[model samples]
Target chain A: MIEKKYRDLIDKLIQKSLMKKVSWNKSSRETEYYVHFKKGSFTVDNWVNDSSVYVDFTLRNANGIEIVSQTFEKESNPEEFNYLFKLYKAAEESYIKVDETISSIINELDEEDTVGKDEEDVLPF
Target chain B: MKRFRDPVFALIVYGIGLIIISFGYYFIPNDLKNIVNYISITGTFSSVYGILVAYAQIMSVRETAENTKLKIEKSNKRVMKILSVSDLSKAIKIIPEIQNYLSADKDESALMRLKDLKGILLNLKFIKDIEELTSDEKFVDALNELSIHSANLSKAMMGTKTGLNKSKIISDLDNIENQLNEFEGYLKYGNYD
Candidate 1:
């Protein structure tokens, strides 16, 4: 089983992500989670073996191109793992900001459509 | 005290007090006749005040009920406005295709897809509610950026290859998809509902 802290982090990330998918690797003894966004996507792999807990952070571009991939173990590289987490959060925020703007654009365009329509054409029927 | 605040209960209590007063009126001595009259006058004023309070309470309750009903109707209308639009899932599907084209360096194809997206946005029905959203500064600025970047990219695709901002256009489209998803989420599970 994955450690409690790692599991909680994975859950939080998955919750924040727009389109998320989760899976388990029986042979590898790891849990994999995928969060897909329009700008990019990221995958988190959590593994707990006999000695230490391992987490892999893989960041992908819009076209599923692997831009950054790194693995960190809890016992050794706590600072590096924290940095990876920070990157993940930054990416999530970027996606959120972009999404807000695009939504506004679409809404504006729709508003124009409504304005262009004559009053007579707007009947509920 | 709580029961006294209830108009019907207060009226019943007052009615019983009047009956008791009428029954005890004859028991008063002749020497205190003036005092009895004074007490009766005070009681009358108190009764009148009670009635006035009860009327005010009734009117207040009625006003609150009307306001709540108006609020509900307004919210329902807002929900209907969002639901009445054309299928936004179409835009969701088109966004990925546009991204694929952009990633593949097919600028011509990406431009066509962007036009298609614009067409879809412009053809959505019952979108008058969107006017309120346009007032937000961040949203307005973002829309403007997307428009400017899109125009620039379109020009480059046409002929002017001097400032081909492909990355910027891709980023803009990405942001659009994110915003579209957010809008869909609000429509599906908004706090207003």
Candidate 2:
């Protein structure tokens, strides 16, 4: 379930290995940064062509189960552009800091699933 | 524990102490009757023996009181359990909205996300404090990271960025939301297995 929501974001993380470039992808004229997970993804887009930036909150996997998927966009002011870079940096820093703890969570979740399965099979009812 | 604290148990213990003292009353005098200071010595000995029994009873009552205090503290551990994770869940659910608000060109809308984000962050801190108080080690880091991400994101929104850092913000929100979801799960089921 979790793997599905963040699939694209996770896929993009492959670029992290190619982090040799310290600057933005200026040539592409579009700078996008995002995080994906089980529930939904929030994307902030910087469009060089239009010289505009906005953020989109896309809810996923919440189809009939939960309608957490209303797409909301907020456009930014040019003066606020630099803050996006800072926010992204902060996000990255926070992620790296807790990376180990996150791994432990996966382990714990696996343990829970394993235990649940074991119990489910044995319950007489 | 209840039995130990009961009046019935106290009576029984007191009765036994009396019985033992009664034996001393007879035995000590019998062996010492012929001695010069026997009468005085026996009386003093029996008195001292009775005092010892009474002292023992007092000590037992004191110890019981201390145990009861400890029991109350044990019950206090559950106080933090009452700090519901539902609030935390609700707070977590707002991250995407906060992200959406961050890009708002209108100060009112953008400022609104800051306030909402602050409220959620406050809730997160509250939950974290409760977890910390209880020494709940499972999801503290996750909760803290969620708060940090939201805070940073909110701080970023505070500026007048004409463009959202599209690629990373979406994925960042996703990642943080997932972490919060994990925390919610842990709150619900992590105690098991």
The TM-score of candidate 1 is 0.37
| Predicted candidate 1 versus true structure: per-residue lDDT over B87-146, tens digit per residue | 456777888897788789887887787777755544432255553433334333333333
**lDDT per residue as tens, model 1, A8-119:** 6555665544332222111111133344443444454445545666566655543234566567876787865664555344444444465667788788888735534578
List the candidate 2 regions with Cα displacement exceeding 4 Å. A1-125, B1-71, B96-115, B122-159
lDDT of 1 at B172: 65
Distance (Å) between predicted and true CA of B5, model 2? 7.1
Query: Candidate 1: which stretches are off by over 4 Å?
Result: A1-125, B1-14, B23-28, B31-50, B61-70, B73-94, B100-141, B157-168, B179-193
Q: Residues B1-193, candidate 2, lDDT per residue (tens digit)?
A: 3344455775686567656655665665566645555555546656775576567667778888999998886566444333445655765767677556544534355345535644553444444335442233223323333333343344445542333343344455566577657666765676621
DockQ each: 0.01, 0.03
